[model samples]
Target chain A: MKFGVFYEISVPRPWDAEKEKTVYDNCLEQVRLADELGFDYVWAVEHHFLEEYSHCPAPEIFLTACAMQTNNIRVGHGIVVCVPEINHPVRIAERAAVLDLVSGGRLEFGTGRSATWTELGGFGADPDVTKETWDEIVRAVPKMWTQERYAHDGVCFQMPSRAVLPKPYQKPHPPMWVAVTSPGTDVDAAERGMGALGLTFGNMAEQEKKVANYHRIIQSCDPVGEFVNEQVATVNFLYCHEDQAQGIATGQRLAQTFGYMAAQLVSAREAYPSRSYASFGLLPQARRQATAPGEQPGVPEGLCIGDPERIIQALKGWESTGTTGVNFLLNVIETIPQEEVLASLRLFGEEVMPQFKEAPDANIRNARA
Target chain B: MPIYGTLALEEYAGAAPVTGELANEEWETDQAEALTLSYEIDDTYRLEMLPAALHPSIPLYAQIMVRSHGSSPVGAFNLAEVRLMTRAGSHYGGYTIGAFANTTESVEFLRTRYGWAVSLGDIALNQRHFGARAHVEVDGRCVLDMSIVHPQPITPGDFLVIAGFHLARVGSDLRLIQSEPSYEIEMIQRGKPRLTSIDTEAFGDVRVRPQNPIVATYLKGSFKLGRVRYLIDPTRPATEGTEQI
Candidate 1:
């Protein structure tokens, strides 16, 4: 299966003026290294006001930097929050097109409604209507990119007929995806004919069921973009080393730190109960896996967080789930040193990546073809 | 790094009376009806309300619950509590700020057995044609008056209630006891929350100014207070200090 690096750009507290800058520089260096190592894509998230968890409020700016610095790696907005107050549809279409043009068409446009009240409430957006707003925005953006001019009087926003300019570098526009966090979101993606971008770390059986449901439902799907992006990519943590124990120990620190920080944020369902948010987003799962009394947290099954052979076995299990790719979180709060992270990436690239034969963008190519 | 709570453990421990044993037995309740109202509070005081072992929840909020027990070992009683949402390490739970019960026996049972910060109060939970309401009074002053207006029927599964964290003096040590109650819900309803009155000072913290009303729920359920499975040292991070009981 194809592999990619995902970034939340977590910056720990007691921030000096240069801490965030150093983190960004280190991430860019990682991206450059990944590109050279034959990694396929680099994804970044859009989050807000989440201290010590995610400082990446502007992923477009970050992804654009990634695209400019790398030649072959595709830059992905792991998601742009589809709420109007956070991002107007036309602006989203316009910015995405510009990025696609600048990146030489190497853009995977992912979309979702922000799942936390820390972000949604900050924007004064209504939690009850985010689902409707996301549906409207996703539909309207594809049309905006394809048509000569677009206009709509929709529930979320009204726009007079105007050319949403700078059409994308990709022929029918870049592939579309939805961030699937809660249960049944994979179905939502499949029905819209978008890629299912799995954000939660479920077991192999759970993932297999979700992938099965997605494939079953997409046969008669209506495409949201020019063609259906019939693909599934799940998220995992990666920290490969020659020594299995050392790699696992470091990886556990990364995982636990990430889980700890994630729990500190307020999810939409926790703060505001609504039918729009079906589950408590991703925080509770992370919280459940946090450190308990007198016991060390064990590595989750099928996680890519060990030596080359172990990671290879884990990825094979994921491949059996019918997933197209794996997007890995490489670090959290800079818990692993930068040099170690780079070495881990290099080792994974040299040892683990060669074991898989599928082209990184094979699904996208086939869908377009 | 997660933000730790800044409440002084020594001062808090000194104020609390040593009651429950370190090893306590589990307790269960009969059929119960509860009215829960939650509201977003001023986050400036979030950290101050919790001990060092905990972390303030993002978008700081508080829950006011008034529950009426149909039958218990201490006979029938009405209970009310104010809890600040917090994170014990990574688990989401509420930290008890103040608790009031209608009966002396219930108060004594809760305080001496579970280390609840409970006192005697006049409390009532009533159901109206429109919805449900709860009123709590202490020292002849109305401390809480909240309601669920025009509550609409909702699936029992939709109501997500978190666990409660009580600071108790357990066998000469001040520990943060985890009180998780499992509810077998029979019926549940949701409605717009209305806070008619609240004395923030009377609840032990004037900084708990309710800014936005989140939700109100009324549920008929049989709940069992499970055995205390964990405790946390109030002076250290929960990750480094939690102990299995």
Candidate 2:
């Protein structure tokens, strides 16, 4: 499986002027190191009003910075909220095209409707209509990227026929993906011929079921973009050390800190009853993962936290599930010191990554061919 | 570390009266009907209302639930409550702002046992042809009037009701007691929420204004309010302060 670095950019409270700046600087430094380490992608999330949990409201700007600082790593604007109140489709298409152009056509476009009331309510966007709006935006954005002039009168937006400028450097546009959190969303991604960006932290058995269903359904998919971007990438936390015990103890801090912050946010399904938000998006799983030290018997199954050998064993299980890639979150609220984080990255690159290097992009190349 | 609540411990202690003793026995109720209306509230006072042990929910919201119990330990009664969504450490739940019950027996029993900030009030929950309506009056003045509109049938599992945290003086210390109840839902329906009137100050805060109606649900079920399993110190982070009963 391919490897990638994912960032939530968590900033702890009592913020001094330098806190946010320092966090961003550390992230860019990590991104630069990952590029040299042969990491395949750098992914950043778009979250607003989630203080301490995520300070990254503008991922496009962060990805642009990553693209500027790195040479080989692909830039993934993993998800731009498809709500019009937050972003107009024309603007999303335009910004993505520029990022692709600047990055030499290394972009993976991920899309989703915002899941938290903290964000959707902050923007006065109706949760009931977000699904419909996302559907409209995803279908339209590709047309904007491919068609010389795109126009539409839809439920969420309306525009006169006009040329959408700066068509992407890639022949057909960058790969498109859907953020899959709720159950059955993998099928939604598969039906639309988009990549399934798995966001929930589930066990190997659960992931195996989702990946099998996704590969099965996509055989008859109708492409939402110019081509079928068939891939599955899941998220996990990483902290590798020479000593297995020390690595797990430290990684527990990173995981617990993130889970604690996540529990404080009100998901759309929790605050509002909507058929649209079928499950409590990602909060419950995150909270469960954030167990206090010694609360759990051992590292939960499938977590990439331990010595390099242990992480390799866990990842082989993920590979057996047919997922194309795994994205690792490095830290939360600076819980792990910078030097250790960098060392972990280097260790992972040197010892763990080489084990699964063969045919990393075989699926993508096949889809394109 | 998580963000700690900013509301002073003394202020939280003074918000409600001290209870008698922690109730050890679980209480069960017969067939019940409930109407729940939830709305997003202004988050400006998010930190000012909860004690140091809890974390305010992002984009703070509140739930107003009115229920009619067919039979209970205190006999049949109607109860109405207002709760601010919050988190105790990594657990998601609600912090009681205010509560009211139609019968004085329920008000006394719940307040002394579970630490609910309950007082006597006039409350009614009625099922209509279009949907369900709930209203509460304190001293003959309307405090809450809300309804569910265009009801559509839904599965019993689709609706989730979180637990509650009540601040009461347990012994000499102010504690946030957890009251988690399990429900066996027989029928449930989801619908658009409509609020005709609400006196926010009556629920103890003017900042609890409802900006947007999220959703309304009406269900028929039976519930068991279990014995208190945990207590938290109001002056520290829940991770460090929570204790098992």
Work out the TM-score per prediction. 0.95, 0.94
Q: For candidate 1, lDDT tens digit of each residue in A20-68?
A: 9999999999999999999888999988888878889898899999999
- In terms of lDDT, the poorest run of 10 residues in model 2 chain A is A290-299
Off by over 4 Å in 2: A288-300, A365-369, B11-17, B149-152
**Candidate 1 docking class:** medium
Clashing pairs in 1: none
Name the best candidate (by TM-score). Answer: 1
What are the root-mean-square deviations of the candidates from the true structure over C-alphas? Answer: 2.2, 2.5
Residue A217 lDDT (model 2): 96
Interface RMSD of each: 2.6, 3.9
Stretches of candidate 1 off by over 4 Å are: A283-298, A360-362, A365-369, B21-26
List, for all models, the DockQ compared with the true complex. Answer: 0.52, 0.47
What TM-score does chain A reach in every model? 0.96, 0.95
Model 1 chain A lowest lDDT segment of ten = A290-299
